[model samples]
Target: MQPLQNAGYDRAITVFSPDGRLFQVEYAREAVKRGTTSLGVKSDEGIVLVVDKRTSSKLVETKSIEKIFQIDDHIGAATSGLVADARSLIERARIESQVYKITYNEPIRVDNLAKKICDMKQLYTQNGGVRPFGSALIIGGIFEGESKLFETDPSGALIEYKATAIGSGRSDAMDVFEDKYEEGMSLDAAIDLALDAVYEATEGKTSAESVEIAVIEKDTEKYRKLSQEEVSSYIDQLVEKKSNDEEETESEE
Candidate 1:
């Protein structure tokens, strides 16, 4: 995909497909620039989205960059692939939220924003067969004074989930989550569950590195991204224990 040099275009740009049909393309470079897969978990405290900042051209060699983004004060979005598409969608979501607030005189809730995203996804898919690459969105915030989480797909379908995981290692992560997650858990417990999920997802795989986390709270309009130090401390004990187990296994072998 070619990057458009000029900025400030109000409408979606059209590109011709091999089948001689026209497709609408929005911001296209944001997804390719970043490396990471996005994950989200929601609880009574609010929603948390986690991303591992590792990108690999091949499955073997991984590099790190920031992949999680704060689309608004209350909502956070992350991407796995096609950084440009993710960013563009994020920007669109933000604008949509703003427009909603102005038009309706009320803050745009997570559900509303999610529908807007789904609409955009439908627009992109209908124009052509080409879909956005690895662009899954985890939308979390307080909607109508209650904490909520929603996951949106490339085609704009949205699901309200208690916890959601995406990206390459998501299946493994979900296994861990299903084994440990409980509704109405405390924030600290939720954080621990999230870390364990990441750990399990990356197990026996070298592609996972650097996790970023964020949280939202009920009655609060903003979602807060946790510090690296804070996140590391929670998982440090587990990592040490895993290291010790590995050492023991090696000695036995």
Candidate 2:
């Protein structure tokens, strides 16, 4: 196709170089890793999405910067990477959800919606006219009393995770998920786990002011992004939980 950015491997997204790598897709993945970390956890009761929302500049409209969005009454997404690209994808998802309902007169399944957006992402790679989205989408939703969570990447691969972390410090976040994730966890436990994952990712950089939390509970209303006070309360509770656990460990020792 056109001249690549990296000269050798970085060309069309579909073209694999001699190394058998799609450099453009890798670049998109790297772009995602540069963003503030976002976490998603699914429990029996519901799903939780947590995001570290550090702005680039004081001039940036803090009020306008949101990493989590309500895709439909039942589905929501937490995004990382190019914020604009994520916004476009989120809007597309919203429209797709509406279109699906209008066509079938029923809510689209969470898995189906995830695949639809991912397939749309893959389309850009096949055509030289466009570039893959430099973003990762973590969608969490409840459909028919079952909670589901999924993460999708620039290469259009969709993966389901009981708990998933994307963007910066994902490796650290994953460790937490591996340790704490349990089947049929309560909403509070899932939220605590999500908060702990974010803490690991940010190395404690996150705070009520710099982070946002959202949840889609058993209620039928929709995804609810927590306010500053709500986030602070969660943080406070998490701190207390950790403190109690440590004290118990010391006592046992």
Candidate 3:
């Protein structure tokens, strides 16, 4: 055999070689965990996602900021933590939708778009197992002959819901939602119910200042972020009515 020299040793060493690619393989289990905070509401009009704007290293610091975001014309997204990751994913979804529209000669439906989002989350998890920005997503749109709503988790799992809530105060939110939910409720009634649910969920623990609301409808296929003034006014009226009713009950008693 030829004399073994430094050249043979270098060849034997697997530093930055194509065959060493396996070493770079990332497992999904190694990914970092994301903090969770977010809420979603669905109604006859469409879907709405409400999130607080505050971000903190700890959940205790969540405050009012502006966490709700529009992903595309017909899509809205909200996050509880890791705002940057949530924004990046939203942007990616917008671009993908545009691409699909141009290439496929048709607009992407909500279901297909949700699937795409889940796929992206999977790819992110697979590629070196990056931690997803800890933010849940609520996607709303009209598709398959009906209005649709989808809730997705950081791990890419998704489910359809007629009306659902997620995040820190989701349990309270759901309770309030059920109290007001009526089958085939009118659009206005549905909007009122959604606002009430969000308010009840955040009340006592957080002030109204910490809340943000957005609405999507089947005809518009767009998310409209409600003005702070508008939301406050609506809530104020509801609170007044509730107080009045409580007083009336006390008098009767």
Candidate 4:
């Protein structure tokens, strides 16, 4: 009998198909691609993380859907893909940070924490019986007085970025960043750019309640989430600017 199409290559996480591809890992990446949009921007002043909660119903509490997490005083993460899997990975990250601090009497470096998480992710891909985590993380923080941003995928690959986005709206968000991102931007400018990216990613469907924002300031080294009111003000500003720009185009015509 002829073998089945794909020859069951994707049946196990440990299996690798010809041309050096792991189908299971790629499938996990697809889970991330289908998740809600999340992005991170790094500037000299700090790092900004923005996520679209995309609450579907009014009955659901906006606060209950958390796509951002604080792993340490200086470290924060934004996630896309399976939220449960993201939470599990976050819990492990928190533990790793604490353990490192207790053992070394100093907070773990941002890169080190990212590597630990990626190591665990890599392990699952090489082992059988367990599936890879269907999530990707955009981790940002202050390390040695410097701001850093890192992105990790389900396949254990890690990349550092000045600004990056993941999930279903990644392309839209990235298009904005590629055009506008600049180095040495102030924290306020970073926040504005991040909000703009989120707005583009969501196709202007975002509201203060359906979005979350966080920042890790380089000087303070503290992670903080912007209050709903602050988020609202920013959203209003962006909306008004967009409206005004449209009006100008109409006048030119």
Better of 1 and 4 by TM-score: 4
Lowest lDDT block of 10, candidate 2: 4-13
Candidate 1: 10-residue stretch with minimal lDDT: 24-33
Off by over 4 Å in 4: 1-5
Better of 2 and 3 by lDDT: 2
- Candidate order (TM-score): 4, 2, 1, 3
Top TM-score hit: 4
In model 2, the Cα lDDT at residue 43 comes to: 86
lDDT of each: 0.68, 0.88, 0.62, 0.92
Which lDDT value does model 2 have at 63? 65
User: What does each candidate score in C-alpha RMSD?
Assistant: 7.9, 3.3, 10.1, 1.9
* lDDT of each residue in 103-193, candidate 1, tens digit only: 9987787787888888887777556445543377778787766777787766456798777677666777778778888988776777667
Model 4 lDDT per residue over 132-157, tens place:
99999999999888998999999899
Q: Write the per-residue lDDT of candidate 2 for residues 85-139, one digit (tens) a residue.
A: 9999999999999999999999999999999999999987778768889999999
TM-score of each: 0.74, 0.90, 0.72, 0.96
Best by lDDT: 4
Clashes per candidate (backbone, < 3 Å): 8, 0, 2, 0
| Residue-level lDDT tens digits of model 3 in 1-253 | 5233322322322222333321111112122123333566666667666654434444554433557777667777666545566677788888888998899977788888888988887564445324444455677765533677787766577898766766656777678766767767655666566666666665633334666777777667776888878767766766776678889999999
